[model samples]
Target chain A: MAKVAAELKYSAEHEWISTDGSGPSVVGVSAVAAEALGDIVYVDLPEVGSTVTAGETCGEIESTKSVSDLYSPVTGEVTEINDGAVGDPALINSDPYGAGWLFKVTVESEGPLLSAQEYAEVNGGEL
Target chain B: MTENYTALYEEHKKLGASFTDFGGWQMPLKYSSELAEHHAVRKAAGLFDLSHMGEVWVTGLEAGALLDYALVGKLSAIADGKAKYSLICNADGGVIDDLIVYRFGDEKYLVVPNAGNAPTVAVALAERAVAFNAKVEDASAITSLIAVQGPKAEAILLKLTAEAQHALVTDLKYYAFNELTVAGHDVILARTGYTGEDGFELFVPNDGAASLWASVAEAGAEFGIVPCGLASRDSLRLEAGMPLYGNELSLERSPFDAGLGGVVALKSKEGDFVGRAALEAVKEAGSQRKLVGLKGLGRRAGRGHYPVLKDGAVVGEVTSGQPSPTLGYPVAMAYVDVEHAELGTALDIDLRGKAEPFEVVALPFYKRQK
Candidate 1:
């Protein structure tokens, strides 16, 4: 089972949002998503200042197994992208929630998200 | 539907292996991280459960003659206790399966085929042997295969057998096999493997799989042996430039197209084998497509069925590809137009609509130190 942060919110597509309720929200694929994706080889992130829509493809994560689209969980203008994770995608597998964060966005609109418990249930207790 | 399991299925399950349906058999995809398992095989040692591969026995006074007619290679000429990689082809020259023929005795041989194509190869062999004095038998159900591959493979394998077998195992050259008793059970230990490393493949009865695996695992523990799965097996083979049956080889392409034309023994063989006429014609008229190795420039690895582009036009397709764990770069085997298959030819692979540049390099991206 993957450890889920209680304070973080998760999307159905497996992206997790850091819920500090502050200026910008950090987003990255959850630990459950990282384990499922295996060893991530490459990460493509949205450019800073680009607008993203919730539940839409904004970037991509390529693993040894296959390529997957990274869906944006909240609609907002991208403020910052993780250059470290982009250069070393394996960080997403090692520290999915911390240093592996994909991008940060200034809040504009949000969609329905799940609590840690709800997200755990959705993944069949895998998260 | 319930899928088939190998004799070591329960053991793999206990080891926390993730299962995948391969060739109708539920086999382990990985026991741990694929990258770790791959490195273990290259650096220390890795054990494999290869029971899913097919083993067919041919026995009779004319067994050698029968196989010569059934396969593309001249099997009868290979010395006893030696193995040769060959291809089973159809009358139309299309490859049915790539197999290894082991001449165990004067009147007996063991044919090992890919798991999925075992039944097909067995049936083809039986059909081809009808006129000869040989009997083909599908012994896959009662047999299991285990491989210990890496730099430390030989050292670990030598400890399991008696001192008498030690000399034979030490003197055993690559592609040679020795029949001996392992833990009081009969086994055929061969010096061969799909990985680009020194390894030994042990063929034993199904009942002996668990014991053999346990003993080998225990003996290999001091050498840091890890039980590997199919995922690493695939990446290792890809780096070795080996063609998988469904991916790089199929009924649609002949051995010539897959760069395996050397396996076709046209000059040495006396009688005409199946597909001889068509393969001869294929040799006379060069194959339209050729298999080549592609070295990916960036991190984006080209996957199977991805288009190989030249000058922004599709000229071929990748058959097997992945990020090489040892080489630290992506590599792929692709079938491209003959004109663009030369070494150092620049090519582009459209990976999900994004083009990644790569260069044609020599096959067997990694070769073991002799």
Candidate 2:
């Protein structure tokens, strides 16, 4: 099982959102979700200027066996994206919470979201 | 989903592996990242419990003759301690399943088939063997398979049994096997593997598999041996340019269409086999499309059934795709028009709605280092 940092916020879809407000909250797939998907090779993230609603699919993260939806954890404007994560998606598989951060988003209006433990309770299996 | 679980289900959880329900089994997909597990098999060694795969035994004098008529390959020529790769096809020459036939003796052979298609393959072999005097018995419940692969495989395998080092694992060549005693149990040790590495796939009785597993882990510790799962299994097999039965080769596509013409013995029509006429006709006419390898020029990876286009026109379909850990590039397998199947031929793949540039290349994308 992966160690979940309590400082970060989470969503029902198992995405982690860290809102230190350096610019926008850095969003990434949770370690639980990344492990489930296997070795990620490709990440499809929205453009920096794109606006997305919470619960909407922003892009996709594809692994060797399947492709899964990368949902927006909060309604926001895309501020920055992780190019390294895009180039080698397995970075997400290795360190999903840290360097494997997918993109950053400026929280639009504090839409639907959950704390790390709350999200863990919803979809948490063995891990 | 209430999927069937493996004997090592708890052990996998203890290892902190990611789980995926494949077929009917809740199997471990990987212990770490797919790339990491894949690299382990190429660089060191990876352990795999392939107990889900089915095994059947054919006994009696007619077993050889029966298998000779049931499969595309000649079973009569297979000597003891040897194995052959074969396919059981439909009357239309479509593959039912790809299997390994182990000639255990003159009148006995063990047929191993894909787990999902075990029942189907067994039924076909039994139906075809009635006239040739063979009996097919599903031995899946009695046997367990463990595929231990990569460069350090032989060294690790040599430690399983004190006697195995000198007689079985060390001296056996590729495709050759030996019947030996392990932990006081009779077993078939084969120098065969799916990862295109120097490895062995051991067939042990069901009861002793757990002991064998624990002992192998203990034996392989120094070589950086890691227990691998189905996730790396797929990537490793893909790197070896091997095809999955459902994805690359299927009932909808004939062997000719899947670039498996090399295995079809059309010239040796001495014995009547399934789909002989259809395979012969296919051989004469030539395949319209052939399975080939495709490498993307950029980061885009083409996945299974995605369309491959040429000049905005669909010319082929991608059968499998992944960023190869060994090659450090996106590689895929596709069935394209034979004219465009040559290496270095430029092509395009449909990335959702957009067209991405790709090129036909020779497989496999990664080769094991000796």
Candidate 3:
């Protein structure tokens, strides 16, 4: 089972949001999503300054086996994108929480989020 | 329906392999990173469990004649211990399945078909052999196939066999097999692979599969033999420009359309064969669409069923494609209009909704040093 950070809040779509709730919150795919995706080769991230809606697809994540949609955990403006993850998508597989953070979002309004224990129960991850 | 499991399923599970449903079987998709497995096959070696492939035995004095009439290849001409790549076609010349027929002796032959098409191919072969003095036996359930493929394949096998049989293992010709004792188990070792590398495929009974696999893995540890799954197998074969049954070769298209006209023996064989007239007519009329290779000029890859276009007009469709792990570029095989199938022709593949620039190239995108 993949590790679910108890410190972060998760969306049903598998995105993890840093719960600082101040300024721009860091966002990345949960470890469960990264492990399920296998080796990610390409990441199409939402452009900076673009407004994204929670629970909607903002970009795509392509792996060798298949492609998946990257959904937004909370409605917000994309404050900054991770160019490093875009250049080397494997980082998302190796470090889903640290260097592999997808983007920073300026939270406008929050969407329904789950606690780490709830997410682990829902998605078969380990808290 | 419940999925079937190979004899080595427990072993794959023990190795932490991710599973996928393939052709009604619970097969391993990957153990770890697909890219790592792909590179292992290219740089060192990779072991694969191919027990899902169907193996049908044809025997009797008329076996050669039965196969000659049933398939597109002249099976009677192939020498003993040699394998010939052939295809079984419907009466209308549509490919039912591509096969590898190995002639073991004068009255014995084994036909290996893709996993999904195995049952159909077995039934068709049995039905086709009714008139001839031959019998078809579907032995897929009782058999297990293991393949060791890469540059160091021979060395790995050499470590398992006795010293006396070392020369036999090294001297085995491509597309040829011999009954050899490997790791104290009797297996038919064949020098053939789909990865476009020098490799050996061993056909052993199901009872001995797990033991054989363990022995090979242990012997190959020093040589860097990783357990490969279907994911790496797909990318590797795609880079080699090999066609997948459901993707490239299908009942909707004939062999001629796939640029495999050579496998269809019309003038050389002396007797009538299945789909002879239709394939002859197809040959005379020529195919409207030809299978060609595509090299992506951009970073994004074109996947299966994507539309191939020329100047905003649809010209073809991609059958199998991915970012090549060996070539480090996107490679694809597609059936395109004959005019757009020429080498060096610039084309575009619709990646989702966007058009990605591609160019028509030769069939294989990568080749080994040997």
Q: Report the number of the highest-TM-score candidate.
A: 3
Better of 2 and 3 by DockQ: 3
DockQ of 1: 0.68
lDDT of all the models against the reference?
Answer: 0.92, 0.83, 0.93
* lDDT per residue as tens, model 1, B80-165: 99999999999999999999999988799999999988888999999999999999999998999999999999899888889988
lDDT of 2 at B227: 89
lDDT of 3 at B131: 98
Candidate 3: where are CA atoms >4 Å away? none
Ten-residue segment with the worst summed lDDT in candidate 3 chain A? A1-10
Better of 1 and 3 by DockQ: 3
Report the number of the highest-lDDT candidate.
3
The candidate, 2 or 3, that scores higher on lDDT is 3
DockQ per model, Cα: 0.68, 0.66, 0.77
Query: What docking tier does model 3 reach?
Result: medium
Looking at candidate 2, what is the lDDT of residue A11?
A: 78
Best-to-worst TM-score order: 3, 1, 2
